[model samples]
Target: MHAANVPTASPLRTILLCFIVAILEGLDLQAVGVVAPAMAATFQLDSAALGWVFSAGLIGLLPGAVFGGWLADRFGRKKVLIGAVILFGLFSLLTAYSASYEQLLAARLFTGLGMGAALPILIALSSEVASVGLRNMAVSLTYCGVPLGGAIAALIGLFSVSGDWRFVFYVGGVAPLLIAVLLMLWLPDSRAYRDQGLPLRDTSQALMGQGRGFSTLLLWCSCFCTLTILYMLLNWLPTLLIERGVSHLDSSVIQVLFNIGGVLGTLLAGRLMDKGRALMAVVLAYLGMFAALAALGMVEQLQGLYMAGMLAGACAVGGQLILYALAPRIYPAKVRATGVGAAVAVGRLGSMSGPMLAGKLLAAGAGMSGLLLAVSPLVAIAALSAATLLGRDK
Candidate 1:
């Protein structure tokens, strides 16, 4: 279903192109976590150093999201997206070829910059191409690519190609390059974007104007809380599970199942949001996640843990997608990218902190259950923010 007011020839193509870009970014985002052990061994890294390696990518994401969004607003969405894809692709290739820990760290940071830049543009495209009523659905569908990408990366990690981690980066690097070429040939810049001819202006400040200051603050808080748990799980779950006496194979299986649940949850949440249930969906997802995380911490049986892991992924990762869907709705088209970018920039800080926080706690002898308990409050904070966010459309 399309929004009647917003007319376009074919929004489906736009949605698909943006979805593919998201998938590639997801692969790169999770690649470091998936191959962490191999990286540590090869580089002779300690846990603290490895934590920085994880943070390095996120650190790069901060500026990338802001600059990329501004660039899209100033230039055009398609051009920025194409450039972002190519940027990440080249850097990912560099990651594969890195000979030292320092080199890998540098490569990952640049790769992250590209990955971060691509996301806001994709979100903007997904929002601009859809009818108003379908905005959330379109965004959710596009963002599903993220969990899908993570699942693919997890699969590749499970059965390593050539038994080397570098091969993983090579696959991550090359696939995006091929996709960039397709994007160049086929992807449409949003019709609204092309038609407006709006002068380049600083729209970031407008997020706080329009009587939307509280809404902006709430959205940022929601993103921060949501991403903290999501990244904590994404980066450290496998290691935590293994530490809890689970087999390595089982841990990887659980992670894959988690991401698969995320894909399903995103799809489900989209339909719910289309029915004017976005806030309710987010609240329920976070509430369910709190339960799942608690259960996962206390449960010892493999079957039970697997089920909880899936539920946790469904709620946590899926809830994050809901925020992405909600973001474009909070601002006018002019500042849409800037607003979303600001929220993402805040979330990236949470993403950066999650792994590092877990690393510090784990190093301090906190067990898996303790770590889960530690982050449980974030779920509540996220739920509260969702319920209280102003200017929510139904």
Candidate 2:
């Protein structure tokens, strides 16, 4: 085999490469929050308008994800990922120069296309390289970068609070460009892809056409609920804190803690999944998340709310890791990427709807307690879906 054909790196190096790509992918997903308030202020926009701007990227993600899976199956994961990074990065850089709200919206929509392509490919790459026993662990480790990237963006927001928000976008956009270059230099084509003799056409047909199963349905429902709850919290937490009388700075701090909890949760769940108990682990995480959110709704003090946020983040965000880890197992290798990509694409719809629904509730004067309570049932539904699916398998 040629060197490019050989998967010769240490497992640790493979993990690191996946993690870096994940960070880039995550930064693309999250960089919006760091500058959203600034965009609102600069554009003199209202909450509803801001919501649209945020949703636009997610809307764009739907098609981008579908196209990306086809490209990954056709060209290769490394190539698709590099192309995605470059596309998103260049658009992100151009966003800093937008002359009007329409221009900014257009830039974000274009950026979302790039963002959409990154995650599914990364998940496929990470899962393909991993040993069967350690597959979930590898996927979890790669996804840990999502929280890490969000945390980094929060830090940038703190420092750039007084400066032009455009600087934040510049940082978000450019860092990934460098990361893409590194990926091109350091990342290898997935050994699994070559070993399986998967040509582009075969993969594309599998993804775009009639491959369906009970497991695929179960995975899709699980991902939709998981992502809905995750995005709901991420989009609303800071504002929710402010509603409960927390200062902006303190709210930001809680947001950081929420993401920190996500990092810990991903690692913890990864270990559990590696031990072959992914379903049980996810159930426990969801239960914990339920309790945490309930506590958050009742808590009045900043400290109490912050602690609740941490617990919620740990459990809820970690639940998402479980979903991703379990996803790759639900489909055969022939349609793994397509299956995973389809789940993510469906999940994106929930993610996009989450914030808008939450915002509408808030606008109707539902308050933090009601908003938090609203998502609890969704988690329960997700836990039930997982149980039903996994139980049938047994």
Scored by lDDT, the top model is: 1
lDDT of 2 by residue, 271-353 (tens): 88888776778777889888888887897777887788788788877887877777766655655666677778988888987
Q: CA lDDT of each candidate?
A: 0.85, 0.78
What TM-score, to 2 decimals, does candidate 1 have?
Answer: 0.94
Kindly report which residue stretches of model 2 are placed more than 4 angstroms away from their true locations once superposed: 1-7, 198-212, 392-394
Each candidate's TM vs. the true structure? Answer: 0.94, 0.92
Which residue window of length 10 is worst by lDDT in model 1? Answer: 1-10
lDDT of 1: 0.85
Residues 192-253 of candidate 1: C-alpha lDDT, one tens digit per residue: 56666773465756889877788899999999999989989888888788988999999999
